[model samples]
Target: MTGGSTHEIRPLRFGVVAPITTDMPAWRDQLRGLADSGFSTVLMPDVPQWQPAPGPALAVAATITGLRVGTWVYASPVRPAWITAWEAHSLSVLTEGRFEMGIGTGRPGIADQLRELGLPLPPEGQRWSQVRDVVAALRELDGPDRHTPVAMAVRGPKAQALAAELADTVTFVMPQIETRAATVQRVESFDNRRGAELALHVPVVGDSVAAFMAGPDTDPAAVRAADSLAFLPSDPAAAAEEIQRRREEIGFSYFVFGADAAGALAPVVAELAGR
Candidate 1:
């Protein structure tokens, strides 16, 4: 049976990961446009020297009614777990239940970033431990009354196990060149462990690939040929159908796209969000 049979089907939800790059008024307008276009959440990535901190950026996005805001993901090893949890809990309170905390053990090449910042680069096991620590601290700060949904961006078996235990949403961080069959295997492995909402991160919509997601050498044709879930057809109808197929075959209900594809994916979101 497909992974969908292993868990309850969640309503389709769409989020946009767009780092702040404009003036306050312009950024506000962009956020409003996303909300107007039927997007549910506006997310920011946590990369030093690339964009403003996601917590403050998300706090601003949460000002727009009906639009939720979150960190596309906070790298757990970048800061102490308690500090990350404190900021996350504060943002949760500021957003008034409209914030979702997405955290991970940093991305590929994170070791270089750590070295650049004069921080010690811990081993993989330690990084995963930090992720768990962040969640535990966040829970303690939240206590029993407040519940801030945690979304974990996981890749390896250890991460998958941790996510199954702690996350409200699990986002699989697949490679740019990973084949469809490989992806199904990854999804099914997690499904066997636990039942949380599944999220698919789409970095390419049609021919346009977000630079943040794909490197300069990434070829769109190659990704499409591999049948990667990271790529989606730009056409609204086709994209919607493909999304539905994914939900049925692999159990992904939450689809997050890069900011560049926001306009292109709007119609699909309009047609399928909440269904």
Candidate 2:
């Protein structure tokens, strides 16, 4: 129901990338800024160094604004599925149903940290198995009492198949242009004739449009057309257009916006909202 018919509608939900910083004030300000900018959701990464405990931030965001808050990718191996399940349910209840859980194989760096914590990194195949099992457990928690959907952030072939089988949504963090196209292609391949919804996590660089354009593979023509943003065009709009172009070419619709920093998201949000 949310995405409409698979072919006719473009899934374009805009959200802020989270963990604005370790500074609590900065984090809160980022949330406030995103809410002010008309963003309805935020994606908090589960990087140990940056992710604050979900308690205070989730509570405050619920109290202050109607922003939907959830982790971008909670490391599946770092915590047991039950504990993650409990925390997710608690937040869902606390936020009055604005919580969504994103789970993935913990990052390689995170695996090293797990070693420091005296935990063994499960072998790669086992890790995916664990993610699948964990997702299954979360899905079982989806009765009327706990209705939040679990989204999976997947990269490789195995994980992609698991995502198609288990997740309500599949997400990808696209750091480069080719990766973006590849992500759409992979999703299309998985969904087959039935188009799938994809949530793309994109980084926002600056206050101006030019900052977004400052990245590699920028198109000059896109810079001319993206004047909606006041700051010099960094070419985020161009980047977004490229992504959309790829999606159309590959026959997939649905995207979620994520900014590297909280402030970096303003131009992107403006552009998406047709400002």
- Candidate closest to the true structure, highest lDDT: 1
Candidate 1 segments whose C-alpha is farther than 4 A from its true place: 1-5, 191-194
Instruction: Please give the range of 10 consecutive residues that has the lowest summed lDDT in model 2.
Output: 205-214
Name the runs in model 2 displaced over 4 angstroms. Answer: 1-8, 20-22, 49-51, 173-181, 192-196, 204-233, 236-240, 243-247, 250-268, 271-275
Question: Residue-wise lDDT of candidate 2 within 118-224, one digit each (tens)?
Answer: 87887778878877776666656665566776788777778877776667667653333343334445555564233345565443333322222134444434433
lDDT accuracy of residue 60 in candidate 2: 64
List per-prediction Cα lDDT, in the order shown: 0.86, 0.59
Model 2 TM-score (2 dp): 0.74
Clashing residue pairs, candidate 2? Answer: 209-232, 209-233, 209-234, 210-232, 210-233, 210-234, 211-234, 212-234, 213-234, 213-235
1-275: candidate 1 lDDT, tens digit per residue: 43434656779999988787767887788888888888898888888888788887888788765688888799988999999999999998998888999998887789999999999988889999998999999999999999899999999889988888899999999888799999988888674345788999888888998745556677888889999988899999999999999998888999999888988889999899999
Clashing residue pairs, backbone N/CA/C < 3 A, model 1: none
